[model samples]
Target: MKRIVCLLLFCALSSALPVYSLTFAPAEETAAAVADFERGQQLFHSGSKERALATLRTSVQRDPGHPKANQAYTLIGRIFIEQKRYPDALLYLERIPAVMRSPEADLLRGYCLVQTGDFAGGQAQLLPLLGQSFSVQDTELLLLALTDAAVNLQQPLNALFFIQKALPLAENQASLLERAHRLLQGHLSDIELEEAAFMWQGTAIGQDARLQLARRALGQQQQQKATHLLQMVLASDVTFPYWQEAEMLLQRSSMDSWFNRDSIGVLLPLSGRYASYGELVKRGLELAVREHNRTRLPVRLVYRDTAVEGVSTSQLVSSLTDDAKVMAIVGPLLGAGAEEAATRAQLEMVPLISLSQRAGLPQRGDFVFRDSLTAEQQIQSLVRYAIDTQHISFSVLRPENRLGEEMTRLFVDEVRRFGGEIVDIVSYPEEGTDFRKQIQSLLWEDYVVDIPPKPELPEFDEFGLPIEKKEEDKKEPEELEYPLAPFHALFMPDYAERISVIAPQLKFYGIKDVTLLGINGWNAPELVERAGRFLDQAVFVDGFFSASSQPEVQRFVELYRQAYEEEPTILSAQAFDAANMLLLGMDDATVRNRDDLRQRLAALRGFRGVSGTVGFDAMGEAIKQPYLLGVKRRRIVEIN
Candidate 1:
């Protein structure tokens, strides 16, 4: 069945070839040139592109003035284009005599220019071919060229005019036409619409008039006619441009659609030592799925154990890929496993939502989305809060290991960039026990000594007390004083226990005015309990703050508590986010292809999640605004 479907799809794609004009020569042409031209045409029709190109080139060179030669030259250019040899194609195309240059030649030349990265030149060549009678192939290629040129020129709105003009020409090439139509269907800004239309106008028009009509009908909200037209169009060519959109729309029109159901997949490290985290993630997924289903989301949740106890990552990927029913795969939260999963998901075109902090994973596939916050983003949040919200001017602290070192470097760089300064940077080994010396050095204390140059005979009365009698009899020695500048804030990248010990000692040295700041790692209870009074005024940035006033967060917190009987961690929130993102994108499988998914994900906005509002950038990285929290009465309290 799969093979049959694949074969059918291939046939559909093949039949959707764009229309192209075929110019015939006048009887005045030389017989040799005419014979060569016919032979080249046969070769082109036979798919012997290289031989066709050579024959066509020879014919054109032999009889440059012959109409047959001009036709052969145009055909040769198209052959080169099909072979993606744009430069060679352009040379032959340009050889066509001015009077022999047909619309097809101009279209082919335009396509070659685009292929050769001369978008502006291609646009100039193609604009003249607009409104001309063209083959579906020629029209589709021309529209594609126009769109590419417009986009390259950053004139998105200008692309739309070309798309509208080419829409009717795409009768036979339904898929290409539909693509062009869809590219312009949305409420695109002037620039975007123009660019999209221009790009579409360059492509060849397909023969499927019904597909074009359906797309137009759909654009006009003529749902029933659009659906019927699309169905008719797909009966002949399922790979039509509007095929995916039609299918999705048809499914949507039905009350019971797959999209309305709770389709979820959970990825976890069920077989390794991190099994506990996996179980936690599974619990979160289950909780969210259940709640979602209860709301009549019609959802179903599935779990995949990304455990390679003895097998290789390849084996794990094979196991996962075998399950065609899986919609979204989440987990394998371990860094190595997540990386492997990312690569595998990219290959399989499955969305793998990683729950690990390894931000170095290159966001590749649309299906391979991550829920983890990057260190750079986290640092930026902290810096913003410190500089803007808290008005902190100076920071003095140390980082523990390589990660900490990198974080410290980022923090310093951001601080300086944000008009802040670093007063003192104390580097401490992770294994260091006593931080007192380091703290004292940063305190900038002044040492003063009072002594007499020569000791006078003691003029003591009863208790052998050397009480000075007169000011003249007393002498003062020179005193040296060292001044130390005070820092307004301290950024401690250490874990809770170390920070706890360092915090109070800093206060003891009359540095109570210095506020303590910490990173996400300091959100642990151990840090609060061990640090005790020292952490009273300290602030930190954390991912999961249950005190959020947002209803989504409140619901998530409640549901999580009911399922796991424990508070949800940032990891759990991330898992939830990953699930939501995958499900949201699975709405349109046609557009759910890897690249499409990646673009959609990047353009997502205002998506609410337990981890806060999650959005993605062009690189497919998650960007979430972190919450600022303070340790108040040993509890993490959100600071507005």
Candidate 2:
């Protein structure tokens, strides 16, 4: 009877305690595990992750099924997570038996699963804990983890839901919204977008969704629905982050709004000191419009003189935008005036293809575009040709004025970019007619030969008895001659008037047999007539060559001659191309509004214009392959 009572008491005590009590291990081992677990908890709570991890490992080793071992595994995994050792965290976290998992254990395991790309398993582990009370930081981490998993799973709506919940807890609300917008747009289907808009109604996210939908509808030519959606947002009391954008879209959707798809405004200095240049641009624009109307729907031109005495370019731009309702404007031929027009056009959300070669006109806004061939483009074409012909070493003879200095700087940078070297750079006065000294420096003639030593006299005797100097018959000093500097090419960035004189002088100074590179200013008739023999086989870049044999050039020349009874200049050709770009783009059914036209223009590629093959870069700057011409047989001809 006594033995029976003792056995029953032992069994009762084992059951009353932990499962480890029934294990075959000694009580001392179980006690040590408890001690280690206690110490690890202290270290973990005190933020000594490394020490706590070691102690917890020891605890698990002492007795695998110890009650404290479960908590020990959890703490160890959490420490690994703190160290960003996801694999190690998973190794320990999964060791906890399913029946032994505490909420904290499950959370750590969820993170490990997610970190190791087991997103579905992690989601399953984390979903049930959403309602549990956790720290604010833990809750945010849990929500973000879920968001990531959903995004990777291609569940944008679910990801958006998680993001929306996490917004109030996010430290940078703006950054979070931006991320949401980027992730959600174009990812959600139409129905999903409508659902999302309803889910986030009266909020910036909702307005962004609506705006995106309106844009899609506009792209598909669903103007009536797009207008209603845009108007709904405008009528709302909520202050949208993109309220101005929404209003712009609303105006774009209405046919009566100031965005006529078939009307173009012409802003040029029609009656000023620059009137001749503007007249050329006007003639080109008229020809383009007339030709376009002959084949397609009639496109009207509304001319607004940018040269009115008391009116500013901004006022002119505004009038063209508001009163004329032109889809796009084609000119403001001067740089300063173009900038002013660009600003006002941007403010009014109108597209203006500026003809000015202003350095940063395109940077004014997306609505501002440039169609002129810039100096940079000229230098690029010239240097590319030089490099292609195996001419690596270069010399620059530039004028010492602002335009000259600017062109020289551009040339130097371009040559360097092509892995070519500038051996020497010499400049002459812009207004001075003489380039002899500058050319001499370019040839290194000024520093080539050392001064000849004075003729030595015979040593005088002690009594100065026999020293006598004989006067040789005086001969005119032989003129010093210099070999051309060791350069493969010479770049001259000057006007035709200056080049004509400089070209002949270059030959006079023994600068023959080297390649000559020039800018658009070298394309004049007199340049080839006066200095053609000197500049024979010399390469230069121009924006237009009316004498070319290309079919487009012939057609343009024929039309211009028949219309205006004259040849077309670069200015006229470029203006015609710009006008035709807008006119031809409007013929597409996809271009329903000014904004639509803006996008079409921005994506223009390989548009073969008479000036050259024209396109627009991301910043709305013209991308063109300028005409590369060379003087051959005393005549300017295209270099194929």
lDDT of 2 by residue, 1-640 (tens): 9999999998886676655435656789889989989998998899888888888899888988776777888888878777666777778887776766887888888877777678898889988988988777778878888887777777888888888888889887776676576554435778988998999997877887887677657545578998989988888887666668678767766754456777899888889799999999999999998998888889999998888888999999878887777888988899878888887776566778999998878876657789999999999898888888899999998888887899989887777655577899888888878778887888787677688956755758699876664567434567766575679999988889999999889888778788888899899999988988998858989999999988998999999999999999999999999998898789999787776787788789989899984789756789999999998888899998
lDDT of each: 0.64, 0.82
Winner by TM-score: 2
TM-score of each: 0.54, 0.61
Against the true structure, candidate 2 reaches a TM-score of 0.61
The Cα error of candidate 1 at residue 409, in Å, is 1.7
Residues forming the 10-long window of minimal summed lDDT in candidate 2: 178-187
Query: What's the number of clashes in each of the models?
Result: 60, 0
RMSD of each: 23.5, 19.4
In TM-score terms, candidate 1 sits at 0.54
| CA error at residue 340 for candidate 1, angstroms | 2.3
